[model samples]
Target: MLSLDYSKLLILAVVIAIVLFWPPKNKSFHRRGIDPGFLNLKVWPARIWFLLRGRNIVEQAYLQEKDAPYLLQSLNEDSLVLPPKYLPELRMLPGGKLSASEALVTSVLGQHSGVDVVLKDRQHYDIARVQLMRSLPTLVPILSAKVDSILSETLAACSTADFTHVKIKEIVSALVLRTTLLTFVGPELCENTELQWLVEEFTNIVRDMAIFLLFIPKFLRPVLWPVLPPTARMKRLHERVRRILFPKTEKNVKSSRDFPTVIDHFVATSEIVDEKEIVAKFLVLMAGALHTTKMSTSHAIIDLCASPECVDELRNEALAENLNDLPWHLDQVSCLKKLDSFLKESQRFNPPNYLSFDRIATSTFTLQDGTAIPKGTFISMAAGPMAMDPGYYEDAQTFSATRFCKTDESAVESGAEKSQWAHEFVSTESGNIHWGHGRFTCPGRWYASAVMKVVIAQILRKYEVKFPEGQRERLPNVYLDLIVEPNPKQVVRFRARE
Candidate 1:
């Protein structure tokens, strides 16, 4: 294993060397006027250090956005960071002209796994955009039930008033994956510990490996990937995933059982249902779906804990609705306006990234501001900072748990018209691109919103969550280039409410 890892490292180093030496195409745009953040790295050591410090470099760009877009040099690519005013233009560009998936694929070595191409394909996204969105109302019942059961099991493990300290991310990750699988894959894997383990392990590998693999060139990924440790483990998990899911899919096809899950929808929609395809797609879907909800829930929990008053508001709202007796319906979850506002407020402060709507220019494209981007230039909008800008939001830097709540006080304070988007987690007005921008915003956001609400509501109803003594403030998030993840070490005290 040591020998194999060293060989993989050697190959990776060689690929990096080759890529670095190669003359990059499309380095300049004729109409470009914006200043580059860090240019002309005359020394190789500075370039290497810059790569290590890429996230800070990009944050600096966000801090220094003047009147135009700014360029930031990443490990292997140069990205142009635009303000939110350019989002409408980005949304208008066709995929052929500026492809978000392609930019992501290139940045993360997605082409090697073939996951990026699958995601980019319109047919695959249609399943998410059309079927998943359409079925969310019906599926929320199952999702809510799953959330309730998972919370019961998790809380039962910590049934004490002495405050069982737990990492919110770990708990959220486990719960979100189980609930999502229950809705997407089926009960078979959701209940099976081995299958759940497989999903968790595979996703963890993808998340860790994708970042490291991004530094390696695409041409060499296939060559070096198999030699890496995670690659072998991922392949083993893939086969096991196939073994478990394929049989069920075939059985469903043979028996013609009508199930309310994504698998059933895929099987019904496809002319020739392929088990491998279905399994692969399901894994990919979980990778995207699970972490997003987990992070969102974790951040929201942190915010609620910081301001215990929000938790009181949510718990009261849930109690008024008789949450425990009522079935967790879409409308019921939607009615948790304070909870909705809390989630949205948390997202505004802690988004996936400072950037959103990432795209690679396919051809020379000019913005409304008359700046031209050359073909092959990577681009994105400053979504996170823009959302937190005081110009767009009053007291933007402060975390207001009930900022979006439709209470008379909040409405009067924030202005009824301005805080309208804060009522729904899916609402994306006032430069809030947590769901991205335009026609290609997250297709499953409605479903995602409902699932998160149910999980959070359950916690609020039964558990009193707070940070350890003197740790009321949230731990700062770890920023890695374009990614912002919740602090893994942050702990929360959970106890059954009296």
Candidate 2:
């Protein structure tokens, strides 16, 4: 066993070295319109490689907006329009080139979903996202039950009595997938061993595939995909996922249950019908939703554990405001202003990915200072820069539980719209190239946030959490494509609210 383990470790090291030192084709790295910067992607290893070389890509055209001199030379024309103060200039989209999600989704998951890419276009995209958003409010009944069961199971799963030195990610993943899968695949199959294996494994596989896709050229992805042989794995996972989703679905009509799940809900509202395809698209959404939610939840908990003073503020607020009875509701959760701010701050500094969300210009555009960007240019806002820059955030680097306290209050007091933390953190009314801009923004954000904030609140309310004896340092951050994840796994212990 030791020999085998050593062999595996040696193999992994060799792979890492090759991937790192392998002569990267500058064409692959600089491939125009493929993906912005390698760092902006969700692929691991490669994204890590990008982060290791973060200095090179820090303000490169692919990841961040460059200054006026070198900006215009990078590519196409037409996107020259003054960016709104609140909006970062997306790379060279001429003033009016409207980018749609259609081509993009199909590029990512449409084929995987086996659904027609046309439906992914702007009109259908907006309709589907809004429908999902509408269905979001309906998830309370589901999420509330989910929160209680998962939290209890988590506390029970602790390693010790006084406190369990637990790796925050594993526990977070266990709870997050459980809650999210309950909604996406429904209750019966949610807990089934077959289904759980599929969802969990499918998530892992998809994450790996995302890295593979980043390096492979866009046009060649279709050809390269089949060779990777992930489909065999997908077949098993999709089969189980379909069985859990509903019978009317094209591939899974054999099951007789007529009840609705998020999968069924999507099928009912759209022209979509192929169950396998639905599973594929839904899987993509799950990765986006689950990974970030799990990571952020982990961050928030660890942040609470790491900062005793912040924890006390949260404890007092929870007691002063008694959040237990009102567990699942958004309004109830909204009352803990500092908790809300802390979550915001944690995400701001400890954003799930080191690189921010990115956008490829369909046409062309310009920045506030008249920096022209060409069409086909991939542009990402300086999210990490913007979020942590003292210029953008006061006391920028330290995770202040109250950094956004004033911003939150200002919005409410001034009768300003309650923008999302992603919106507020990125400092925009417009959607981010990362989370999405305007119409393309992530709809599941509210649901993801609901899960995150509640998890943090519950932990703070119920346990005195801290790092296990000697390990107080928050784990270093990792980057996959553009997403931020914790430094692998770090443990924490929880004791009764003493």
Each candidate's lDDT (Cα)?
Answer: 0.71, 0.57
Q: Clashes in each model (backbone N, CA, C under 3 Å)?
A: 0, 25
lDDT of 1 at 433: 75
After TM-score superposition, the amount by which residue 399's alpha carbon in candidate 2 deviates from its true location, in angstroms, is 2.1
Per-residue lDDT of candidate 2, residues 182-218 (tens digit): 7666666667776666666776665556556656665
Worst 10 residues of 2 by lDDT: 70-79
lDDT of candidate 1 over 1-498, digit per residue (tens): 999999999998987666566444344431122222223322344345554765565556566653457665554455677766666667767777887667766666665553564653565567778898887777777777777777777767676648888888778977888888777767665787888888777667766677567555556777887777767776778889888776544354323223467877777787877777777777777777877888888888888888886677788998876545565777777788878888888998889876777788889877776777888878877777777776666677788877666445433224223445557888776457778767658877887898888888878887888899888588989876557788889999888776
TM-score of 1: 0.83
**Would you estimate the TM-scores of all the predictions?**
0.83, 0.72
For candidate 2, the per-residue lDDT at 254 reads: 21
Task: Kindly report which residue pairs in candidate 1 clash with one another.
Answer: none
